[model samples]
Target chain A: MKKLLTLTAVGAMLAAPTFADTLRLGAATAQTGGLAPYDAPVMEGIHIAIDEINAAGGIGGTTKIELIEKDVRSDAAQTSIAVQELVDTGVSALILPCDADPSLAAIGIVSSAEIPAISTCASSPTLPMIGGDYMFANFPGDNVQATVSAAWAQEQGHDTAYIIYSPDSQYTTMPLYFAEVFEKMGGKVLGQDTHSIGQQDFSAIATRIAALPEQPDVIMTSSYEPDFPSMLKALRSAGVTSQMIGSDGIDSPTTFSLGDAGEGVVFTTAGYAEEGSPLEAFNKKYMDATGSESQTVFNAVGYDLIKVIEAAVLAADGSTDPKALRDAIANLENVQGATSAITYKGTDGMPVRQVSLIRVKDAGREFLGSPSPDAALIPAPRMQ
Target chain B: MDIFLQQTVNALALGGTYALLALGLAVVFSIMGLINFAHGELMTIAGYVLMYCGIAGLSFVIAVPLALLASVVAAVLMERIAFRPVRNGSGATMLVTSFAVAMILQVLFQNLISTRSQPVLLPAMLSDSVHIMGMVIGVNKLAAIIATVVMLVFLDWFMKHQKTGIAMRAAAEDFAVARLMGIRANTVIAGAFALSGLLAGVAAVLWVSQRASVDPLMGFMPVLKAFIAAILGGLGSLRGAVAGGFLLGFIEIYLSAFLPPEMQEFREPIGLGIVVLVLLFRPNGLIPSATLKAEKV
Candidate 1:
């Protein structure tokens, strides 16, 4: 009887860890706050990726992905605690949305744990430089978009550009970088105005922009979608006729609903649901599966992020070891994706990929084309 | 000079929105002595109602009234369900309950209406602008200012002339004494919440028109601003709340204009700094009421 009891205890101990082989994926995002617009789609994308990967035989052939989602509620401090909770649950990797400061705060925890964390939409230049090798961003940093936007404006013969940026971290840096490039390219910056993130009235700034010796040929604003419509509306109401240009943050259906006020407003972005290209195929799959259109680029990146992780796992010869998978992901090159040519260069080099410049034309964003490397005439010091 | 005038006009327009928000918040604070943390959420609920009505094919004219009535009903129900249960409880209990109510409403809105940003469509007239004194003013701004002035006048008249309103003021002054005077304490508290809802509804219309969008979290900033405005004006003084709202609005815009472009983002901080200065000079706020006494319980 004693020998039989010993054997049973041993068997139970052996079986427990096999059951624990399930791969845990953590998602820490702004589930309920101002950033919900960006975070919700990213969450949807993560779930879709998990479902697809699990269906196609998950990591190590047996390990299934289990998602543990936590709401950071748009507070940077709360994100640290959320990440810690995920770490406690033995999350192998984390998927985050486009939050710059919060991501920076959680980087140390993720790095120390040696877990690979990929942010679906955070494109701040500072991210790559500060996060070292452990962090990866699915999209090109804001500087790349800023460089392309300045070149596009100059290509359209806009010599005088009025730039407005939110003093909030992510949006501010993008326009500031673009201004640096636009100035380097011999285009005069008429006036550089800064606004607080949630300021409803843009009249003072609009009045100043309008009173310039010569009204700017183009006004470039780097701000999120919620504030962009009001800023544009105020600018137009104040009789400032300068053509408005915005960054990737403005690419949403909400922009079109701004009605004629958003007409002639040009912005640079990567994905649009209306385009029936191969890119739209992925979007269509997402829509068909979820019964909702993938309206933003973050959703595509979310899908691509899971695919990249899957590819990395396969490339590592079925190694579920975190370090080996991390190395494989860092060494990713020439990987074709629905949105762009993704190449995950290690901490030392930039990720060389093709980024598209899209414009909102006639109430929907249309793909302009791939940004020509040589066509980008401006040289701004890369901050990241 | 034109820019200066334009900025001042902008300040006045913003002030109108702040004043209405402060009025709504102050009404609840004065009568119930319960800081309705959910006050802004109530406004958001009104905005959502309007959005839903519009989606259901109701015209803006009909939608606005329906939204306002819904908001009033919501506020009254909240008083009955959430606030009334904790009426005689500790302040901490009341505060936590209000926060709980806010979270519940926020989650409900997220699941039901939308978790993403949605534009608040405006009528064409509200979107039009008229140039006055070299400053551009939208019809929306003019309407907001007119609405605020009329509401303030009507509120003053109600408090001074109406029996229920006088009883509410008496209750706010001393609840025990007012109870002895045959005032129904529950009715007075409910009326205060209803009034708050009415003001919130009007403010929601003005605020949504400015952003042209409404989200579940839209109430957050406005609520914080109104709280600060009420404290700046005097916690229990309705007139003081109005004064503080306009004061905060002017200071924020003035700082935005005078400060360097890079520093314009510090406008809120500057406004708060002024508040600190005011508190240091006048601890009871700009306009204090003699009847406003600290509660022992």
Candidate 2:
């Protein structure tokens, strides 16, 4: 009778599916090129989150989360290949960068593979709609920040604004989206100028701003590091001096190079480096682990996504099954991350997070209060 | 009126910078018949050196000379290691040699430094603009025009009067004949590379000053535009190079400024199209190389 009972136990164990005790997360992001500076911090944040999760007994103490990373090098073609490799290697979930164009290149593959994927920082509002149910935006869409900044501008009584943007993906699209929102709020878009990345002269553009029929109340630009400081310096030198505003592209600490010019520069971001915020402990831990301070706001994207995945993995009951994990992610709500309060709302998986507005003072960034754009009080007229 | 005047400043500043780059290309082409495709890399190196010095907290005054010196050394070494060995090679071979040099430097820099851009801070005065004649011009650009004019004058004088410069011009006329006529091939070729490198260094500072960022590929567009200008003015004709540089600059700046907002995206295509049309009409370029015919034998 004992032998028969032992045989039945072995048969039951064999009949059930067996899986690895370790849960794997794959990060396919640009490790080099224009995306490197932003993505590097993101990867560090991911590892940091994983270490914290692992230290806390790692999702129910039975399964430890492990990460495998692939450097896409900012090439869209390579992104697809990287995605396949990660999927084949058996990652339960994937983390991606915030750019919509390149993210789209591989998002489809992750969907077809039927694994849950999250973009840490991509802001194109349309990203969530196009990416399948499993595709989630870890950071809130561009419209959220645009609305907040536009509302802030209106509160400051700046009714007319000028825009200068570069042709790069986020820099081009995001600011123009800001223009659309600003105009919808009954603000005048005085003029718009566009320059390619690394353009040598902003004088013509700068001059165009200076010569406007009436100087604008603000010069809002969608520009990033290396270029942002330079462009700001040029505008300051051109003596326009109207309040300068921007999106997260101007969120880097390196803007300190602008000296006095960077002062009074206002921008909106998902993350800011303040001493006693909720993220202080996480920030210190990241600095302790990485041996350097974070550089850009996108750092939160990586950290937040990992946190999201942790919750999802736990909810899915340590299942490495892609469909199960994806459903868990879609169900996430009101999860606090190092960056913001993240909630994947409704069926679209469009994350809703409170946007933080920041301004540069004394060559440093100061966090302004989180001003939520009212959804019901007034609809920002959509401008084409 | 203010807009037009502002764009005019933009045009002159661009034209002046382009002229310097074209002149650099012209000097080497005149002597070597090789395109010296790596000339732009010299510019990149200068910007890198400037960026390094800026990070070290060195004053711009001290950094500028060091950056130029670095560019000159790089240019000389490039000729020694890359160009001299293949001096007698065919045009196709030499062209490939320049490309190989450019690639090697580009890759080396990319690996050693971040492939991403490194911001270089300039003196605060550079970004300051002065109001003059109803136009606000960035002071750095005004200085660029003045500096380019000075450099151009110095280059012209050196070419016409200096013995080494005369030898360079002679070699351009006929490399083998000049070598036989007691014009040292080594000195003339080295001098051409040195002179070209110096101009590239100056142009690099002016070019980088406006953008305030340096990257491995920073030189690509500037050099490509300079190359186009060199070809537009007759590849080896120094005078033609300057004219073509200014012409191309004016075309690009004005097109961007005046093209309707919707059509502005087509500016680059329009500028390139103009170049193509000019090439079609002037097959040898607006100013072809001055051919030195042998005495009727």
User: Which one wins on DockQ?
Assistant: 1
Off by over 4 Å in 1: A1-24, A59-64, A88-90, A273-276, A346-353, A373-384, B293-297
Candidate 1 is scored at a TM of 0.91
In model 2, the runs with Cα more than 4 Å from the true position are: A1-19, A51-60, A166-171, A376-384, B83-111, B183-186, B291-297
* DockQ of the two-chain complex in candidate 1: 0.62
For candidate 2, write residues A1-384 as lDDT tens digits: 756755653454344222436777788888765666667667768888888888987767766787888888777888888988777666778877657667778877987888888876777666766776767776656677777888888889999988887655653556676787788888999888877765666665666666667998987776775567667766777778889888776666556556667778888888665677657767787778878776665666677878888777777777766788888878778788887778774747767787888888886777887877776422232222
CA RMSD (A), model 2:
5.8
* Residue B149, model 2: Cα distance from true site in angstroms: 0.8
TM-score of each: 0.91, 0.89
Per-residue lDDT of B211-287 in model 2, one digit per residue for the tens?
A: 67787767777888899999888888898899888888888888887888877656678888998898888766777
DockQ of 2: 0.41
Tens-digit lDDT string for candidate 1 (A1-384): 756755653453345433234555788988777677777877777777778768866755665677889998877888888987777656657776566778777888888978777776777766756776777777666777778888888889999988888766764557877788788888998878777777676766766676778999888887875678878877877778887878778777678766677777877775444466546777877887789877677677677777777677667765555566678788988666667767886433235556677765677666666674543543433453
Give the candidate number with the greatest TM-score. 1
